[model samples]
Every structure is written in structure tokens, then in C-alpha cells.
Target: MKSELQVFQDYIRGRELRRTPERERILQEVFEIHGHFDVDGLYLQLRQKGVKVSKASIYRALPLFIDCGLVREVDFSEGHWHYEHIYGHSHHNHLRCLGCGDIREFENPALDHLEEQLAREYGYHIKGHHLQVEGYCPGCRQAGAFPAESNFLAKDSNDQ
Candidate 1:
């Protein structure tokens, strides 16, 4: 696997931008996390490492990374967008907890079959699909984490 730095370097090269130490540093930090991070979070991490970079620089560089197909943008309903390294991986859907903000990745053959069947029935060719399920997680439910009439919530409400 190409290091994230190498990926970023290639991106800069393809864009005809001269490679700089600051760009390398930023890419290194982003690659190390390899998870969701917003612009402010990335800036804070770089600052913690004594890297003096402006927020605007990181923001501008992110789109370049995206354009280069080295990163992906994810919206987790947290009122902020996050980015992750794509690394030439196949697509997968996300399951998220609306209350706890926990995210899980899953692949379902049944869902795939359903999409294919629907496409065939409609006389259309399937190209791609994105499915996201968001709800309270089991732990959240057990803890009465959401405002609903779940069994745990009912028990607690009855006790009260």
C-alpha cells in the first residue's frame, strides 16, 4: 500500500503543484488518523505536533485529496463533515446510532440482491447504491438512551 504521504505527493504532482514540507506534514497527520476528522480537528492535531499551518490551508488541501481519490467525505449527522482515507477500497454502507454517534460498516448480500432485482424489474441496469441506516444502538436502548417506548424505557418509566 502506498503511504498516505505518497498518495498526497502524487496528488500534488498531478496538480502540478510543487511539493512542500508543510503539505507532506499535513498528509502524514491525516493518514495516521485514517478515520473521520473535520478541518478543525485536523488543524488541532497538526498544531499539537508544532506544525504551524492555517485552517484554510488544510481546508483547501482536503478537496485536492478528494479530487485525487485519496480521501472520502462522510456525513454522520453530527453537524460537521469528516474525511477518511479511501485507499482504493470498495464501497460499503454505514449503520449509525443517532443518539450515541456510533458508526458500523456492513455488507449485505440480501440488500445487493434486492437492488439487482429491483433494477431488473424496472428494466434498468444497476450501477451503484448507497444505503445508510441510522437509529439508536442496542446499548443506547438498554440505557434508555433515546426518548422512545422501548422495553427498557417502558420498564424505567413504570418504575418511575
Candidate 2:
């Protein structure tokens, strides 16, 4: 398998975009994060490391990374989007806890079968899919973490 830097460099060259140290630094920081992250948090992380990268540069590079299939955007119903590097990772879905805003990754062959069936039935070519099952986790349910009305309305800062 090709390294992330090699894949990114190939993509940049194909698109005729310059390969700058700043963009490479941003890419390194992005892949270093194991979990979900937003642009503002990424900016802070790079700044703390004394990397002189502007958030604007990060903003510009993100679309390129996504286009190259090196990164993907995930939404947890928060106001903003979070990103994760998908290179060298297997496909999976998310199980989100509404009460505590915790996210769990899960994989199942059944989902893959369903996608195949749907594609054949509809005669549509499927690229990929995102499935997020939302509910209270065991700990949250046992602790009664939700409000009286509904837990679905709960939104937290840690909703990744």
C-alpha cells in the first residue's frame, strides 16, 4: 500500500497543484488524529505544535484530501463537520450515544449484503454509504442520562 504522503503527492501532481511544506504539515497532523476532528481543533493542534499553517490553508487542502479518497467527512448532527483519514482503514459504521455524545465504531457483513441487494434491485452503482445508529448507550441508559422529554434533543460538545 502507498503511504499517505505518496498518495497525497500523486494527487497534487495530477491536479497540477504545488506540493508545499505547509500542506504536507497539515496532512501529517490530520492523519495523526485517530478519531474525529473539526477544522478549528485541527488549527489549534497545528498551532500548539509551532507549525505555521493558516486555517485557510487547511480549509483548502481538506477538499483535495477528500477528493483523493484520503479523508472523509462525518457528521454527528452537530453544527459543524468532523473529518477522519480513511486511508488504510476498513469500512465501518457508527453507533452514537445521544445522551453522552459518545461514538462507537462497528462493522457487519449484513450491511454489505444489504447494500449489494439494493444496488442490484435499483440498477444503481453504489460508491459507499454512511450509517449512523443513534440511541442511548448501555451506560447512559442505566444511569438515566437523558432528560425527561427526550434524549434525542441532547447535544454536547463531544458529539464526535
lDDT (tens digit, per residue) of candidate 1 on 54-129: 9988987888788777777888877888887767666678899977888888888888899889998999888767
Q: For candidate 2, write residues 59-139 as lDDT tens digits.
A: 999999999999999999988888889999999999999998999999999999999999999998999999999988889
Off by over 4 Å in 1: 88-90, 109-129, 149-160
Off by over 4 Å in 2: 148-160
User: 90, model 2: CA deviation in Å?
Assistant: 0.2
Residue 76 accuracy (lDDT) in model 2: 95
